[model samples]
Target chain A: MRIALLGGTGDVGEGLALRWGYHSSHDVVVGSRDPDDAHAAADEYEATLDAHGRDAKFTGFENAMAADRADVVVLAVPPYHVADTVEAVADRLDAGDIIVTPAAGLTRDDEGFHYHPPSAGSVTALVADAAPDGVPVVGAFHSLAAGRLADLDADLDVDTLLLADDESAKDTVAGLTEDIDGLRALDAGGLANAAEVESLTPLLINVAQRNDDLWDLGVRFQ
Target chain B: MRIALLGGTGDVGEGLALRWGYHSSHDVVVGSRDPDDAHAAADEYEATLDAHGRDAKFTGFENAMAADRADVVVLAVPPYHVADTVEAVADRLDAGDIIVTPAAGLTRDDEGFHYHPPSAGSVTALVADAAPDGVPVVGAFHSLAAGRLADLDADLDVDTLLLADDESAKDTVAGLTEDIDGLRALDAGGLANAAEVESLTPLLINVAQRNDDLWDLGVRFQ
Candidate 1:
């Protein structure tokens, strides 16, 4: 499968790019508004893969061009940029193509980080509303720590909750997710439950902040 | 500490009563609308503890009476009943007393369960509004599985997310939570974040429903 990481210069985008590029057979395309930045990030990802003894070719493109050729597009943008990112690539997505959102709305106060969901209820729903017709949106990887995921030395026994309205699209994304070594994918019902999945990101961050030993925490269900 | 389990005949109430009664030195009081039911449930809980070779005393009382004597009151009632349960026990809660809510609003469909938060944003918030002034409300144990908690034989490595505005009260509740063997309590922030903690319940249920080996799943952050 070909996977496009939109906003591919960001932390989450880079994490997904390196993991998928190193661990799986999926062709990874790094996408950004600036073609130069995308190419730079793709070069960095390729170097990391090479250090790990994997020779993987990563393509860099403008967001639209990247989305146009991929079977799956991951909105690795920040929460506020998810809708616009999806809109920018809307014309490129086909009916059967899958869009995955790892973005979560979070607001911080004196106490700790709290979930600040979009008016559409969740980032997944925001992308669902903004995407072109017939393109299915799936919410996954919301609870993962970017620092932990990007560290190839860290053995992940972490689980990612998957949510989507379309079963086939959800299954496709789940399969892609499990291909990353040691990461388990659990179906967390349909799009209506996206808020629950997205909210976990802030909760995990808050927990990590309070505990000394629990830095960059990731959730595992047993 | 004296801990009261409101709606003590219910699944959650029974699980908490059993765990606290068997694992900690705290006094466990079972409360219900009906005194007879409370007494019966308490006796059952005592018998279960006895079979496990733990000699623990359990008290049974009406909801109001239970709240009057306890230092921490746990509202183990369902989401719909949370407000009324708090209201019924409102007059009994003295200043500095703590009220804990484990209820999560859930609505199910053909696909699976989705979070249906109350108009107050979360059941914890609803109880906070209904409780008497100065009675601090803390949200904890929102994501624990009742069956796993009730089974004394099953070892728990579960983490319960705690949320509250009152720092001292939050600390008090956190200390109480760690008394239950194998349960670690993580401070998840203030009551504004309760929806995130509550919503995790249904998300866990949905994930457990879809996965075969994930029966009675519980979360551990690593």
Candidate 2:
């Protein structure tokens, strides 16, 4: 399957790009507002994979072009940019194609980081509202530690919770998620539960901050 | 410290009573609206500890009586009853006493459970508002798997995020939490972060419902 990482020049996008490039045979493409930046990120990710002795189908393009070529498109941008990113690629998304959102809105204060969701209830919901009809929007990877995900040396024996109304699209995304050896995906019910799933990101960050030894903490459900 | 589990006849209350009785030297007390029920639960908890050959300080009383006798009083009732429970025992609370709330408001439908926080933002915050000044309110254990907590055979190799504006009270609760084997307590900042922490409970329940092999799931941050 082909996968596009929109806003793939950023932190979380970089993590997903490198992980897919290393672990799966899928064609991984980086998408950015600036195609040059996307191309540069794709090259950097490909070089990292090459160092690990894996030559994979990794490339980059403008957001819409990437969406056009991909079966699954990930809006890996920050929370504020999620809707605009989806709108930018709206015309390119075809029926049966899946749009996955991993972004969560958060605001930081002197005390700590708090889950600051958008008016639509969550970033995933915001993306859902902006995307064209017939395209399934799945919420996953909302609470992943991007730094840990990018580090191939890290085992990532953690789980990612998934939320979507469409079963087929959810399953398709879940399959892609497990292609990376150590990560497991569990169904967390429908799109209405997006707020709860997205909030876990900031909660995890707060927990990680107060604990001295833990940085870039990922969650495991036991 | 004398720890009172208000509404000790319930699922979460029973779990906490048993765990504290078996794991810590703190005097564990069961409090219910009906004193008879409290006494019965206390007897049952003591019986469980006796079966395992451990002698511990365990007892029960009416809600106000329990609050009067204890340094830390846990409002272990359901979300809707939290404020009233506090009001019922308001006069019994003394200065420097602490009230802990493990409750989160949730609504369920065909899909699964959703976090239905009170207008005050979170159950913890509501409890804080209802609580009299000088008696600190700390939020912890909002996401514990009750059945696993009640079962002594199960190892609680998990973390509980704590929220409180009172640093000393938070420290006290953290110390009490670590007394239970395999449970780690991480500071999740002040009570403002309570909504995010509270939402995790329903999210976990939703995930557990969809995944057959797992039920009563607890989170561990890695």
Candidate 3:
């Protein structure tokens, strides 16, 4: 499968690129507004995989071009950029393709991080609204820490909740998630439950901030 | 410290009463609308502790009476009953008392469970509004599985997110949470973040429903 990481120069996108490139045979494409920046990130990801003695298929392209060539497009962009990013790639997406969002609307104050969901209810819901008709949108990986995910030496026995209105799209995303070795994907119903899944990111952040030993905390269900 | 479990006949309330009764030296009071029901629940909890060969302080009382004596009162009622339960005990709470709510507003359909947060933002926020002046309301244990919590043999290396504007009250609750073996409390900002914490419950339920060998799941941070 071809997986395109939109905003591939960013923290989350870079993490996903390296993990998918190193752990599986899937084609990993890095996407950015600037093609040069996307190529730079893809080179870095390639070097990291090389250090681990893994050779895999990897490429870089502008966001639209990357989406056009991929089976799954991951909107690994920041919360503020998700809607615009979807709009930029909408024309390339079709019925068989899927868009997965890991973005969560968040704000911080003197107290701590809080889930500041968009008017559409959640970032996933916002992405669903912006997606081209018949192209399914699934929400996953919202609670995983990018730093932990990027660290190849880190053993991730973590759970990533999946939510989507389309059952086949959700199953496809779940299968892709489990390809990363220790990551377990659990079905969390439909997109109506996306707010609950997105909100977990801030709670995990706050927990990591307060505990001395729990930096870059990710969730496990037992 | 005297810890009162209001609506003590219910699942969450019974779970808390048994855990506190067995794990800590603090007084555990089971409170219900009916004193007889509370006492019956208390007896059942005592028998469970006796089987484990731990003798502890345990009692039963009406909800109002329980609140009158407790340093910390846990509103273990369902989401719909939280407001009226808080109203019933308001006169009993004073400046030094603290109220903790674990209620999450949820509605289940054919698909799965979805978070149905109240207009007051969250059940914890509603409790905060209904609480007596100077009596702080802290949200904790919102994500814990009652079945897992109540099972003494279940090893819970789980995290409970605490949210409250009152730092001292949060500290007090954190201390109480640590009294239960294997449970760690992490501060999750203030009451404004309550919706995020409460919403986790429904997501957990949905996940547990869909996955095998994941029944009565609880969360751990790594």
Candidate 4:
């Protein structure tokens, strides 16, 4: 499947692109506002693959162009930019195309970090609202750490929470998420579960920060 | 240091008991509402140590008795039981004896799970309010999953967030948490950060539940 990562120059985008390029047979494409930056990141990732003696299938393009050509487009941008990014690429997204969001609207204050869902409720909902009709928007990958994800040698037994109103789109993204070697995609019910999934990231970060020697904390359920 | 597990029969208690017993010279005490249950858990844990041929010290008692004898008491109960449980054990606790809570209060609706801070604010604050005056309450281990922690074979490079108003108590618990193998401790400021740390668990669970194969999802920082 053709997968385009919007904001592919960011930490999460790079991680997802590298993992798909190295471990799966999918054609990975990097999309950015700056095509040159996207091209540079793509080249860097390819070099890392070459150094590891693996075949690389990755390319770079502008966000709209990438979204226009890809079967799956992941909005890997930050929470603040999610709506604008989706709106920027909305015209290029067509019917049956899946757009996945890992972004969660959050704010850091005197009371540490808290979920600050936008007027649309969440970043996931915001994406759904921004996309054109018939383009399915599925919320996923909101709890994974980019550091562990980007490392090919890192053996991850991690779970990625998925939420969406659309069942078929949810399944498609879930299939894509699980295909990357060690990841498992579980149904966290639907779009209502997005806040629960998104809020975990800050809590994990706080735990990792406060505890010594536990810098990169991960959860594993029984 | 003397350490007490108020809910030693549960997953987190078992993990803490095993790690501390195996790695530290500290005395480990198992506590439960049922004295017999505490004794049984202690015996089972002792057998685990005996299997490894490591003679680490452990004992069993009722919750109040265990708290009475310990320097630090850990409330390892679920979020719902935290307040009543603390109230039950309050008379037994004394000044300078620290209490720690790892519970995150959560509410799940059609829209997913969220950090449902009581009107009193975060769970840690709730715990502190329930405790008697002069008893230092600290919040740690808000995001560490019981499954990963109980598995000795799992090499978890994870973090534990520490939140406390008292510097000395926070430092002490921070040292204790890092004493466990492959766990790191971080200073997350104070109890103000409790909501952020506590909220991570449900989000992680939601993510784990939604994904295929990603059971017991965890985080690791870059």
Fnat, model by model in order, equals 0.78, 0.85, 0.85, 0.49
Q: Which runs of model 3 end up more than 4 angstroms from their true locations? A: none
Residue lDDT tens for model 2, A116-216: 99999888889889988899999999878999989988888989999999999999999999998888999998999999999999888898888889988
Residue-by-residue lDDT tens digits, candidate 3, A1-222: 999999989999988888888778899999999999988888888888889898865789999999999999999999999999999999998788999999999998776788889999999999999999999999999988999889999998898999999999999999999999889999888888888899889888887887788887889988
List chain A TM-scores, every candidate, in order.
0.98, 0.98, 0.98, 0.96
**Which of the two candidates, 2 or 4, achieves a greater TM-score against the reference?**
2
- Would you list the C-alpha lDDT of every candidate in the order shown? 0.91, 0.91, 0.90, 0.82
Candidate 4 regions with alpha-carbon error over 4 angstroms: A34-61, A109-115, A143-159, A178-189, A203-222, B4-66, B77-81, B84-92, B109-114, B141-161, B165-167, B174-189, B204-222
Candidate number of the best TM-score: 2
Put the candidates in lDDT order, highest first: 2, 1, 3, 4
Cα lDDT, model 2, residue A102:
96
Give a tens-digit lDDT track for model 3, residues B103-129. 999998887888888999999899998
| TM-score list, all predictions | 0.95, 0.98, 0.95, 0.74
Kindly give the stretch of ten consecutive residues in candidate 2 chain A with the minimal lDDT sum. A49-58
Mark the 10 consecutive residues where model 3 chain B has the least summed lDDT: B51-60
Please give me the DockQ of candidate 1 compared with the native complex. 0.71
lDDT of 1 by residue, A142-203 (tens): 98888888999888889999999999999999999999998999988888888878888988
Comparison by TM-score, 1 against 2, better one: 2
> What interface RMSD does candidate 2 have?
0.9
Sorted into a CAPRI-style docking class, model 2 comes out as high
